[model samples]
Target: MQKFFAVVAFAAAFLTAWTAAPDRAEAAASRIKDLAAIEGVRENQLIGYGLVVGLNGTGDSLNNAPFTKQSLQAMMERMGVNTRGANMRTANVAAVMVTANLPPFATQGTRVDVNVSALGDAKSLQGGTLLVTPLLGADGEAYAIAQGALSVGGFVAKGDAASITRGVPTAARIANGALVEREIAFKLGTMSTVRLALRNPDFTTSRRIAMAINDLLGAPAAEPIAPSTVRLSLPPKFNGNIVDLITDIEQLAVEPDLPAKVVIDEATGIIVMGQDVRVSTVAIAQGNLTVTVTEQPEVSQPNPLSQGETVVVPRTQVTVNDDSKKKLAVVKSTVSLRELVDGLNALGVGPRDLITILQAIKAAGALQAEIEVM
Candidate 1:
């Protein structure tokens, strides 16, 4: 109850501040690096199939998981163990898939974190150590070698009729486990033009970026080839030091124009609104209806003079609450996100209730923003 009150208080304070917010759309400037990234500068996904060894009798069963048995046989033969006809039955191994993100320009011998998830019905991977496995790229070529002790941060315990589990025990990670053996060489600075890709594509943002760059360099070197990409050519003055030009371009600050948006996470009852969210004068009515049912069992016995036997009686109680006195409150036109939040809060609306009200306002063509449910 105390926590609930605290949340309500926090929401009230947040709304008060939101309704009194300044006009940030005209003055605030965002760094170029935060808004754009150089094209071809991204991470590559690397995955490999490997087997995790050294389990404490909680690994996959041979009879139930044939793939684990086959993988174990293949691994044993590579280590000079001839078991072509031997019936091997061991519960100390698990087949797993190793995954890692190869950061761009990763050099040889540098280690990357690797994630190992069980591909079979392994009871747990808490104490397992991944065997020396070659991590491959999409082209089926080995790019890195991963091998280390797994760090499964959870455990499993079972008892007679009940069991308690915390986190997932079948997935684990190894810090700095995979050694990089390949590199993707990307040519920058030498190209005639570099593309600046905006993380969020907007025409106004693209035009602003181009104009900002043109003003910064005193020339029209930056052009908006597309809403998301800004084409920048090498100026003759900066050809001798193209790296310096790139450095300067990334440091310029420009005021980015963003569309008004509201994001609501229904599962968590979290509501997020952009600074520009506004709503026209509206009225909202909110209430809740709760229904409850209760079951009660009673025992009845026959009197001393009666011929009735003892029996059990079942009883149930149902109650319903109808909130028909919901009051409709008037909300004035709210221009800023703070005002909108404050107005909604005035109606005594929680996150879930606010979601419904905002949707209704949008349907009525009063909400001047996009509503996204997540």
Candidate 2:
């Protein structure tokens, strides 16, 4: 009997893997770095206020958008050109915000890509050249200088009574347009110890990561700092060679743990369950009930000699109907995903109906997974 039960369980598992996760059934060992990242070694955001010029009458209106006019006047004043009384109403300039990411270990004169976005009611930023803009970090310190011709992937044009547009003409990216002016002093390799922060916090995964790192070096060099972090002490042999140590650690593969979950998109009538999801023995009854109400109007007129006024009356019709093909099914506790799904299908429910059934099962404490409603 035990041998027969084992074979049934194996078959159920095989069917579940083959059908549910058709393309990806195998849970292979993933790289340690793919599931975690080193703390404090990240990118920094840089922002700057700049202007995009040379627009073909699609730039911000200086009259309605006084800020654009004021910005232009201030820039001209900085260049020693006195335009205090000049009323600039041309659509050849636009106020924009320049942004870039200062990568860790970046040095002076290193080029980084920048994103330009119009800050005003400009129709578009196409064919515009960004002025000399200094990108600032969170500390309000200038870290990079961005200046180049904008490469707008979209365009907009309005003629007489019609207009044509595509993509987003108000935003653009310039490849290698910003020069790094300051380096963020990140002493990544000089630390006596480094910490790995897990992308997902799990006690089991954290313990496994520590075990994997220790197993690689044949010593207890790593310790679990938290459920989401692991700290490792640099060995004396690896002193001043932190990069080599990190590379080895990243290459080491470990099976990352995933939580059992069922996601339901009620708007699209889509239901998805994780491989580890299960349901206890339960009975489900499902049927559809619909109620429809409609309105009807009628007009009545009396004979002219009778001296009776014409009248209009309103009537409403309502009907209630229940599906006659209701189904009631008993689901047995299944240790395999295939059996669980097969039992649910026996109820003859669609995706939308399955969402309600799953929710009901969760409320009844039969579903052994988290149900995420989206």
Per-candidate alpha-carbon RMSD to the true structure:
2.8, 6.6
Query: Model 2, 211-255: lDDT tens per residue?
Result: 999999988888998989999888777866777789889988787
Could you say which candidate leads in lDDT?
2
TM-score of each: 0.89, 0.86
lDDT of 1 by residue, 1-374 (tens): 35544665686686676445585444468888999998988888899989998999889988888999988989889999987778888989999999999998798998999999999989999899999889888888888999999999888998999887879999999999999999878766577788899999988898899998898899999999888989887788886555677788888888887799988877867777776788888777888898999989899999998999999899999999987688987777866666666666777667777778888989999889999998
Tell how far residue 164 is off in model 1, in angstroms.
Answer: 3.9
- Per-model lDDT: 0.85, 0.86
Residue 70, candidate 2: alpha-carbon lDDT: 91
Clashes of each: 3, 0
**Model 2: residues with Cα > 4 Å off, grouped in runs:** 1-26, 293-319
lDDT at residue 61 of model 1 (Cα atoms):
89
Model 2 error, position 85 (Å): 1.3
| Residue 212 lDDT (model 2) | 93
